[model samples]
Target chain A: MTSIATAGASVTEQHAAIAGARPWQRLVLLAVGLLVALGLPWFVYPPVAMDIAAWALFAVALDLLLGYCGLLSFGHAAFWGGSAYATGLIAIHLGVPFPLAVLGGAVFAMILAVPIGYLSVKRSGIYFAMVTLAFAQMLFFIANQASSLTGGENGLQGVPRSFFGIEAVETDAFFFYYAALPIILLGMWAAWRIVHSPFGRVLVAIRDNAPRARALGYDVERYKLIVFVLSAGLSGLAGGVFAVSHGFVALPELHWTTSGEVVLMTVLGGIGTLWGGVIGAGLIVMLADYLASSGFDGIGIVTGGVFVTVVLLFRRGIWGTARHLWLNRKRS
Target chain B: MTSTTPTPRCALRTEGLTKDFRGFRAVSSVDLEVAEGTVHALVGPNGAGKTTLFNLLTGFLKPTSGRIMVFGDDVTGMAPERITHRGVARSFQITSLFENLTPREHVEIALQGLTNQGLRFWRSEKLLGRRRDEVDRLLAEVGLTELADKPTGLMAYGQKRALELALVLAVEPKLLLLDEPTAGMGIEDVDRTIELVRRIAEGRTVVFVDHNMHVVGQLADRVTVLQQGSVLAEGPYDEVRADPRVITAYLGEAHSA
Candidate 1:
């Protein structure tokens, strides 16, 4: 306990000492980030840029649970894929507009999340992860077997991007990119808002010391369940958007690997920092794109190598480490 | 002798509070009562069920067979958080804290819990700015104003205990269960903690378990000594300390000399 306290104290002191950069500096950084995000499609494939934005939103959703709530979910793809299927089914069957379809999908994911989170939040750490994974795998099997509804193993295809009677996004890549940006940005902002709220502070308190939080009259499990559902809703929203943008929802979206990928994105960018998810997602997506285009078949090996290096050397992932160094330098 | 009538002055009471772990009988049919606004101390040699009994009272553990009442309300088998909502709060023996959070944030979060706004994900924590003065007062009460902005993980051992006290106080609890608040503190730290407890115990009921005889001697208005699982003796510190069973329990027959 003493050793932990000493180490924590030093880390705290370091953060305090390097409380550098004013509010305007952060605003400028945000502006630069927005410009980069908006301008990226001109330099790269527009669809790829859209994929990064969608995945970044997905990563942020997972971070709400993993980072703020201190829950490590290994089966978030259940919500992601589950929402993708829901959005596709809604758009195809009901002929609803894209935004409403996405909302329907997100709401469906949240409904699924309620029971899953209820049972899963009962356990924590690896057990919690395993329970969520079990439920997700169950959903994956159902999606596979209900082929008529989900298109089964063949995947759900031809999810239209008709936003309020405008079908321009189907042929124009830039239109699709612009349509997806606001949704992704809104999802990210909501996540940011949650983490900075009183509710978010309690979630952090729970993550730090659940027993203490309980002793202080916070229903720790209830808080966890709420965050879990919120995370699933956000992930579902992202997945819904992705399904519409890509015009397909496949079985791979529900697979465990997809869940693992988001975890990697969160950790690689920096856990707990909101924007770290975006940076991490951008890096991974761009890297994978670059690798595939360059005829490099070992993208897994390269991604794994980067993950290992970041874990060992930076410990805070790419953005967190960079922020730490920047703050320290500013302090000096 | 158990009283038939529930006294408003009695802040906490337990009847036949028995707990068994695989038939090990950690605590057996113990009846305990604490009056309002007094510093009550539970002490025993190791494995005397001090911690277990504390857990049972604070709703951390369910008694195998018994009833726990706080201020005339049956709180037995209630959830810990429910118990806290009924004006009971506790500090852990191991110094539990939100290590990554600052002392100010810790107090703020605790204060937020009191406002029942802990689940408000849509509202900014800045809305809690209305409670900033209260947060500062708590930090100052714990003598942590200077270090309020420092992360609790970085706090010194004594400071952590103080922070824990402030966190408990933030709940505005009528009863504070402090488990070994001065367990591993140095003399100065111990003295400071005792003083802090003394100041806080003025209007609150404090039921603490302490291994430190000096702290118990200084602060405890009443002392209960346990041997094995049952109460060995109960009285003011001098009388309990003078009990032959307690003496035998502590030093065995050799030290009874």
Candidate 2:
């Protein structure tokens, strides 16, 4: 038998190297991100900035499943909106602080994700998307019919924001933005930690080749379900914050369109890059706010045009493509 | 039939194993026994159920009516991962790997399975640094030490195949089922793989399917020849190669090709 060294230089190594972010690059990106996040409200309207923060978290949460786990969910609105309603009810009925209420709603979303993810993870690609979409639509119908509990078409309004019994927020959007920023930032940090963890590597393995992962002794379905639940809980955190910040949980929150919008934001920013989603959420929210103020009813047309361009031109999404180029240049 | 009949120590055994796909029998009633600590090769023409048998042994497919036992425990109809837990590991005929992951990452993921920490999403991946020595050993064992940090997508087909073998070795299974360990390889890679398999097969039972007779001749301690999903002959490689039925089966496949 020959030792491996002698077989030696006979084998050819092919294919382009996939770029990885170094520790310094990640730290620098994080610092820049913190600066932008803190300085956004100073430049933009406080309400719009609040929407950006909430939606950014939502997009990051969705990207956890879609980009990392390779599971595309078309009905994430269930968790986002479901958490909003749960958070609103908890705040209004229990009179707890906003953070406690938000945490409670996020937990509720995780519980809901258990069954949906259980059934949906068995499926792949378009079928998985359809299963999630169907479940969200069913929840939408139920919320509309529950009338008294959900407040029917009018939604749950006057969802007060209290900070440990001290009315610090006091129905002030600007003040609420600073408080919610930490929670949203926490959710993003959790998402980042997950993708860089051992479990996240397994999720990527499963995404790359499920049967192969199974042969390696990992439970592919269980991993998928775990990530799905985690993503939902994080999304719920964002939705809960959005509800209390706006002091309302409306029908549009649960609508399929909201689900579509978040997907758009994640893809536009970059599906697998956690930061890409924040950039995406920020871009879409700011664009929509600007368009609405300009009395531009065709906001969809412009957003749709941009989405088409991104899909056609920058297939890896904004942040993904940028990082790819940056890494390639560094290598050269 | 006698009470004094001696049973050999077998690493894997199948009794009346059969698989039917919509009334078409891919594998007929097949009883196979592989003694412990040997290289066993399954060779047949295309569509003769060689891969199917490998799949059956690995729990990738449930037999229609049969029993599969590994190291004396019945693993019939068990899940693929459960079969792995029972000290059986397999490599795919086609290259199956995480394209974006590095070879080191691949070995780490497989090594993680041995521990209960694979699901620790909250802990840093740097914790896997504890297994750094073992991971390096596996990568170097397969001659991928230099390219260990490169993503598999950028690797040659042969390098990817070598990585697959490394992944299987990381589990340190008692029995290894390799499907076409040298399929679609250049002459040099094929020779390298043959020597590599010979080195790795020490003290472990190996069951592999290959179209390359050279690989079979060089590595197989025993050969089981299949024809139309049934065992046509079984003996040492030299004896099996001399059998007329085995020769005819090979000739038949060659003619068709």
Candidate 3:
């Protein structure tokens, strides 16, 4: 029954001490970003910032399961798209308040994520990723087949933004950005807190050494399943926001293409950097918009070519690259 | 928690443990009994199913037949983690430390076990002071205190062995199974490790696999020699080492002492 402190006086206690500091810093950065976002629409378009907010939340959710738990789910579009459909469906039919409809849609998306995440949890690595993809494809078909309910391939349209009785839609475009910005920032901040907590450390440990984590008396699979579901539920949260912001729920959002796009955003931002997901989402959304307007039907060609270049050289993404440069400069 | 009674003396026992991989026998019908408060050594040539037997005992590999008893509870086919929970900790023949993490963090994960808080995330780490104390003590025991914060990949040959032992020690098990605890250490590290293993585990049962005969003689109270897939010899260190059978297994011929 020897204690850890008495045993290793020389193994410096800096790891946790250093890692724990990042969270408070993240919170500060999030507060600053939220403030800027609140006023962003006065300068730029509100819809653009709102789009970035939704996509940012989506990328953060993806990173939670991918960066922390090490589950590479390529089929997350099922939940994201499903949530969009759910959000739109509830708003159009039930005429619930806009936030409540989004919440309902996200909950429905979570319902979908449960079974798929459950079966996929039994697998690991590429097999787990592929299994999720397969299940998502099945969902894509269900969205297609249930055209009457889902509005099919063409998608359900004219979703309304009721803005919690603000009558903001009648006021100006700036309304939705301020509303959605707080939630996305809060979501990212919450993600930071979870990943840095003892729980988050265990997830990283599970990812790196599952057998060891199991040996440490952790039901590693249970932790993985919980995170998987939570991340999916959050993605649904983001998707609900998307449908509310755009006033439409479409089939294309649920496609594997959308899943691939999120993955690319996460990777292109650098895998596990704290704000990397948000930054990645911003760049990708902006880049897609730029490419489409420039008459480049081959945005894929341009983006894919850039993706290859990034992976080949700066595999760490933007934040990672910045951190590395900071540390390297400090050292030299 | 030192036992007041004359240390049970019958800590871990195995009865007819067997394993088969696709109709090929890896380990068959092996019985091993180890007393409490003693360092028992297992010595065998390579491919003697020593690692396989370790796996069966630790619940990493299921026995096709037979039973494993720890403090007389039948733990034969239980999962590895469950077995670990039942006061049996192990080190793999191949090192199993978290490669991406520093050794200190690796040991903290182990210390978390000692704290009885595997899933407690909301509590402040300040509450884990006692567990952290034990982890540091074990690291110091293995002489790994100096290199603890370094990544496990940065560990030197003998230090890695010591770290592995500390990982198992984190659980402070009643019975410890070590696969090749000294398989790849230089002379200096091997001697340091042998002393360290004997010191902290003074009253615990230790079943370790080793290839060095001198190490067995110096450390073991009883020795079991495995050859191929069966027990070649089992007795006191001198008795087994002196046996013509064990000599033949090691030297490929019989010689009297």
Candidate 4:
């Protein structure tokens, strides 16, 4: 987000240089992204499209903390999987509408984030990552032992998608995608709005130099905690949606590897670019889906290879490097 | 240098300030008092606890045992931000800035800090434009108006220092603690900074640490010499400069160099 625009630079030039798109260009990009999101179900399986939407939201939420706030959370699965289980339980027992369940799940995630973020934000860098990971692992074990509530290894099965009791909506994949798209998009828009707001600017400053931020009379810890909670809430939203989409909540969702996978997706797309997560999620999810369909069991090998290539070739991830190129092109 | 009247109000006073780091007493019991609207320079040899004293006053480091009073308000052991809210602002000896941010953004952030809107996440950054005139004035005050849009990472050391000064000035602080304000500056930049400091020190109490005797001689109304974390001498620049102990402790090294 730190654009290297000099004095007297035009707004478009500055935007293009700093963010890789001007206002109109961004609108165009948004339009293209929307079209792809809408059309993906037609090209791929509708279930896969829903997965993309859900995972994209997940990556974007993670990016809010990792990219904008300079926090790397290695245990975000606690929020995602924890929410998935919550949404499942809420839907199963309460028989509420899936939207309400999702909302409840998101809130639960935020509540979970409070203590986790409070402790984790105090330690930075790898320690922050480790603290978050430890919390997620603890949750994973709790869910494992509480088989009666969580369905144990079998996972929470048959989470009903009660779209106001609409019969066709639950059975139809395309309908469900459209239904979940709004929530995912809303979450994404909120992330965009947050990173673009004055609060986000402070987050960027905190990420860049926290001590400087604190010295500037900002409560740096407070800012980190708030962002951490926000990110967890958004991640919970994505997880709740995913659980509803798949009609099941599995133990793997809360696993450390799932956390690692989302991190990989975020890095592949672009770390700080809010939209980059969507692209990264699209690639990884689609690749995994394709590999699964083709009976290729080595999904990790291929994804890991792709990740290495992206890190080596595109140090700024796909979108950041693209923005760099665009800026250089404009400069030249 | 303006001489204080009898019993001038203290802008900042430390009653036996002390800080111990893992058995090393970086700062021992030191009583420091700065009269209102005057520049006080803390001159000491390397590792003489000048920076440590600044840190304690600013609440970056909690004092081991003592009281820090800013404008007669007890501020000891308070957080740095709280200390700032009490009209005290500090600049680091090492320039600490958001490297990815522009000078304009830095000034805006600092200006935003003075009000209630800085923590508002829902509002657009456009709201900061209401203080555009103030931001521009501060930028112009520090001669950063032309380069305000440039990222600080791309800025020259002198320009970055100037921007840092602008940020500090934007706070409109009552008591300004500048740790090595002129450190790592070119000669022209140092002269410019001295002039800028002189201009801004009119209505504020300034405490600073500097090695350049010329800068201290030109700016400080009074000098406090420290040695091994204790106050050695305190007086006007000429008197302290000529003090035998002060010479043996600090200025002697400078004269030799």
* Candidate achieving higher TM-score, 3 or 4: 4
Query: Where is the poorest 10-residue window by lDDT in model 2 chain B?
Result: B1-10
Segments in model 2 whose C-alpha atoms lie over 4 Å from true places: A1-20, B1-6
State candidate 1's DockQ: 0.69
Residue-level lDDT of model 3, residues A1-332, one tens digit each, is 01111111112222332443477775786688766667667755677778887888888889888876777889999988988999998998888877788788778977887788889988987888899999889988998999899888788888887765787652455776667666666667667666766667677678767777777666777778878877887788899888888888888898899999888888777675646778788888778778887888888887787778877787677756765665557557
Of models 2 and 4, which has the larger DockQ?
2
lDDT of 2 by residue, B1-257 (tens): 12222576789989999999999999999999899998999999999999999899998899999999888888999989889988899999999997667899899999987666878989998877789999999999999999988756678999999999999999889999999999999999999999999988998999999999999999999999988899999999999999998898899899989
lDDT of each: 0.86, 0.88, 0.76, 0.87
> Model 4, A127-216: lDDT tens per residue?
999999999999999999999999999999989999986777788988888888889989998898888888888898887777677777
Q: Write candidate 2's Cα lDDT for A1-332 as tens digits.
A: 01111111111111231235457876897899999889988999988998999999999999899877888899999999999999999999998989999999999999999999999999988899899999999889999999899998999888989986555565677777888899999998899889889998888788778889989999888899999999999999999999988998998798899999999998898767777888899899999999999999999999999999997888668977776676568668
Mark the regions of model 3 whose C-alpha exceeds 4 Å error after superposition: A1-44, A169-172, B1-10, B114-116, B120-131, B253-257
Evaluate fnat for each of the predicted models and list the values in order.
Answer: 0.76, 0.70, 0.29, 0.56
Ranking by lDDT: 2, 4, 1, 3
lDDT of 1 by residue, B1-257 (tens): 24466464789988999999998999989999999998999998888899999899988899999999998789999989999899998999998998677888899888877557988899887876678899999999989999977666667888898998999899998999999999899999999999999998989999999988899999999999987899989999999988888887888733643
Q: Kindly provide the TM-score obtained by chain B of candidate 1 when compared with the true chain B.
A: 0.94
Separately for all candidates shown, the number of backbone clashes (residues 3 or more apart, or on different chains) is 1, 1, 19, 0
Cα-based lDDT at residue A43, candidate 3: 59
Can you list the residue pairs that collide in candidate 4?
A: none
Q: What is the DockQ of each candidate?
A: 0.69, 0.55, 0.32, 0.50
